[model samples]
Target: MNGRITVRIMTVVILYHPTMLLNLSSRHIPCPAKTIFGRRGPLVIEIGHGNGSFLRHLAIRHPDWNLLGAESSLGSVSRTFRRLKHAGTTNVRLYHGSGLFILRNVVPVNSVHRVYINFPDPWPKKRHQDRRLLQSSFFKLAAGRLAPSGSIWLTTDHAEYFDFSVANGKAAPHFSVDTTADPPAAARKTKYARRWIDEGKIIYHARFCKESEPAHPIKPTITTQPGTMHHAILQGTIPDVDAFEKQVHAFDSGHVILLDAARPLGDDRLILFVRVDEPELTQELLVEVRPHEQGVFVGVMPFARPLSTPGTRAAIRITSRWLEGCGLRLQQQSF
Candidate 1:
């Protein structure tokens, strides 16, 4: 086998960022979500960037705006990082954290000018409906973090997910959702989107903008017990180490655990992933672990409901104790 030919073949599918005589280091740091880039340039955030093709295209096409991408999958993250590095593009930042986590913590409230959720996994099972990212709670959170005139651009091939997204967006108290069958003329098209269109899947697009607040305040909260500290760590938020260890102890000895310590491209933020055997349970328990020094940081664990509940309080106590024992501080946030 000719290795050179094989490498060339692989390169065809992988797109790289173009090299410019700009400061690449400065563009690589992960700043707080509210932090603006490029002085007067509009800030754009893309969630679930697959191979970074679309993002790369957008970055090249719109040189004035700063582009930020959040991709949770490690494979995708590696691919994206390589694409950006090879292309020598310095105007984009990549995060290995979840889109929601980035929006909540890294992004400052009312700082984002545009948001994109493209080709996200469509949790098809009825029982797994809550896993969909376009749910009511997500909409509310996005609305809160979005700038007044900022807009959310969503595209999906799954008809059900698309319709569900529209419904959730419309029902959202703050957003006015608008749907389109075609991509906006100026929007960059992704390979996935183009493929879906060619395969006769009617692509669904929606633009959600916050028009006003709800008549009644919507307090969105995610509740999980203390023993689930690892969940948050994987989501790229700081985690309570003591509680995390206790949660780990609760697991069966035979269970598999995986942890990846990663630094986002262009930022000081460190992303730590604690993976477990049970996918569903793992996702539910995710907490954000942020490191202050090299190894120390605070963990914020959100409750599915208010922590005031007796059961919830008990779980938090046990988890807090475990985290303290492990040398990590813990904080509980209702929202």
Candidate 2:
């Protein structure tokens, strides 16, 4: 809500470069091995590569395999980058957002050779069980993405979660559950796994092999386009800084929230921090309001690299209407 919020986000962008991170905003993932890694190899994904220890191991063990790591934590992504850089690992790429998004959107169907889920958060609380990743629905979803006879290897220290994954896999109708299997040697080499082993913890492991296609095959739903741009021009005066307030716009698919407004110290332009929340993805974008010859321009900046989705278009319209409420007349616009 404060101006300082923009400062924090800028600091993060300055620290991390774009080489290791995938641009989830892209519409289709045609061929990641050639596009991302600059070579062809089998695609392997690690659902939650904690600290990149196991991911680094995989890159070293199989240089011919293209490895992808999906993690939800920004700090973990940063730490993993440091480790990969130190080890000079090249076959690995990281996604610094939701693992589910990468699995659902970025990964091509029937292209993945293997998936490694090491020590996923158990979400032990009953109410939080729905948040766990290894659900029956996940097994169904993974089936549509994995290659024929491809497998998912899981290793966790929690007994209940291990059983939960096994039971869910059995119910999915796509995977053959194998509870009596030793995990890959790389699984126990993670930081948490090594510490748990030293403390004499019993770690559970399983391999869910993809047996067949889903009974009801699922397709990837992509509402965002890579090149499409949305914006609007209004004929009116600039909005009063004090009049800016948080506003929410809801659509059938998702909702967009205009969180706050900030004006640079010497610039006449205003920046609106927005949060766009959809079913599978959530993005933070900055909508810029700048003065034009006839009126004002309300649109997302090119630097934001925002994917043009329904929610995103609604965001620009919401901002334009808000400015109209502050005495701006709609002239010509695109949404």
Candidate 3:
């Protein structure tokens, strides 16, 4: 993979049309955005809708069923979005993140009618198996969220990965597996599935149906703030922040990384975007430490809604202490 080529392509797509990408964090609350095309119907999720080619046809074929694509790659998301928009389809929307993120946080539990995973990257290397998307944890999570009648459809060209997935699916406590020699014809219509078919490669397709919802489903709760603020206030003349350097702080619960720091000229506000990685949560948040009517306030920026958690509050405390090191007087604190 050429990094330069990818960067160039991503820059072009994002520069041309930025709004094509949808915000997964805000779209779905207790339920997904229902009423697509003025009709409420079953929801079909396609994870890693690579080029959006199959998605184009899938949406066209099932106008009534809402199609939600969860993809991580900005390039793929943008490309598929353009394709869907060109086709003028209204039943499809995309979530710009991992499949698990949307499933666990956004999509309503027991609401997904079907899920399609077509040609996922088979991280064939043994050392990279930890990164594979198909795992017991994912299966359990999927099972808890899927309807009683809901099913998962998976197709991959890698035989080893195919067998591995099937083994896990069969062992899932909440699912019943049905192996298919060939995936759905709609899947084969995609460029990926077609190329494999042209090469006479054997593609494995399997459907896993939910036996029953998990009796004790692990539905993690995200503690939300009233409006979108996670900060503390202080009063002092801000000292000069010498330099913006990479800094990492580790703790038992999780770790925080001060990735980069920035500030605008003639403005007393200092913006720092840091990555907070916790047990099951990962977020990159912009923290603002600047002058307030009282003195200096430190808080998560409202630009993006980051899940406020123990780690984030810890981040505020850590940032304040770091600021004290850089010359700040504490008047009051609220975290």
Candidate 4:
């Protein structure tokens, strides 16, 4: 094939490769290797696999291992997917979500044999420390998912965050911290590692080994079932757009905020822009309130595939009930 034809074919493969992308919007435990990759093998995870250098290296280094990459940025995921596809790496699967979400919801307990977190964002300011990923809560969550004796290897150029992670690992239950060990060679081959190294920055490494099961059982934070249509039926007048005020509802694990209401120029539907904040995922989705012959239908808009999570369900339910207060009668709800 010509060079142009070869480039187009590769681009199509990278864009259309469906099997490697794990959909976090669906609530399926994606471990055991067989479920997603059609075979059983040792499982290894690389959090924040920026540009796919480390992820591709791990896949190439250990072809028998099932590799999972959790990345928060869609752009990075796409770039990494392109690199991985071009490398013909088949043992790896990537998710465009937080590592915590993958551990808590998608990965089964005692399934992971190793985890690599290379040069995570430090969130340096003291006020933003809570935003950092290597906290006590994460160690506890990791403990529940890691196999007995499974280890988490962390590599970072920020000394303060590295020390903070070591402290957090010590404070968390069921993990033994080792700060003197050498990081895996593939860890240093990441883009961030090379950049920091060339700039004369000192890198840090640590290993947190799971020594025992978690003292408290860790469960999936989002309990709502996926693939369900969340809506409500009302027998009274349709909600008035002018009276729509911002409403916030707090739940055990997350909160929902009803931002604003609008009506389409030529349609009888009211659009509600909602913000849902859960521990692992935050989604800004639209909910629609439509007037039907039987009743008023209030549900999540089907235009986008937002995860059917707790906060999402709450947004629909709260909007329905709030409309009741605004002169609409509640009839039924599916949440």
lDDT of each: 0.57, 0.81, 0.75, 0.81
Q: Give lDDT tens digits, candidate 1, residues 20-133.
A: 211112231124422434355677888998888878777878877778788776468668878777777767877555777567545556667899888889999999999899
lDDT of 2 at 190: 89
lDDT of 3 by residue, 149-244 (tens): 799999888899988888998888999899845677888778788999899998889998998878776574453444544577776666666577
lDDT of 1: 0.57
lDDT tens readout by residue for model 4, 1-335? 12543453354345455678764455454435567677988889988888999899889989999999999876788899989989999899987778888888777888889999999999999999999999988888889889889999999999999999999999987989999988888778788999999999998999999999976658876644457857788887765566556778897778998877778799888888787889878776778889887799998875435777777778888888778887888888787
What's the TM-score of every candidate structure? 0.58, 0.91, 0.84, 0.81
RMSD of each: 12.1, 2.2, 4.1, 6.6
Deviation from native of the Cα of residue 205 in model 4, angstroms: 1.7
In terms of TM-score, which candidate is stronger, 1 or 2? 2
In angstroms, give how far residue 318 of model 4 lies from its true place: 2.6
Which residues of candidate 4, in runs, are more than 4 Å off? 1-17, 25-33, 170-173, 236-252, 259-269, 291-293, 302-304, 325-327
Between candidates 1 and 3, the one scoring higher on lDDT is 3
| Cα shift from native, residue 91, model 4 (Å) | 3.2
Q: Which stretches of candidate 1 lie over 4 Å from their true place?
A: 1-40, 185-189, 213-247, 250-335
Kindly list the per-residue Cα lDDT of model 2 for residues 1-335, writing each as its tens digit: 56666674774575355667665455444334567767889889998897999999999999999998998776788789889899998888888667777777677778789999998998999999999999987887789888899889999998899889999988878888888888777788788789888989998998999988765656666545567768899987776587566788897789999889878789989889888897677777889999988678888876635667777888898888888888889998898
The total number of steric clashes, by the backbone 3 Å criterion, in model 3 comes to 1
Candidate order, TM-score descending: 2, 3, 4, 1
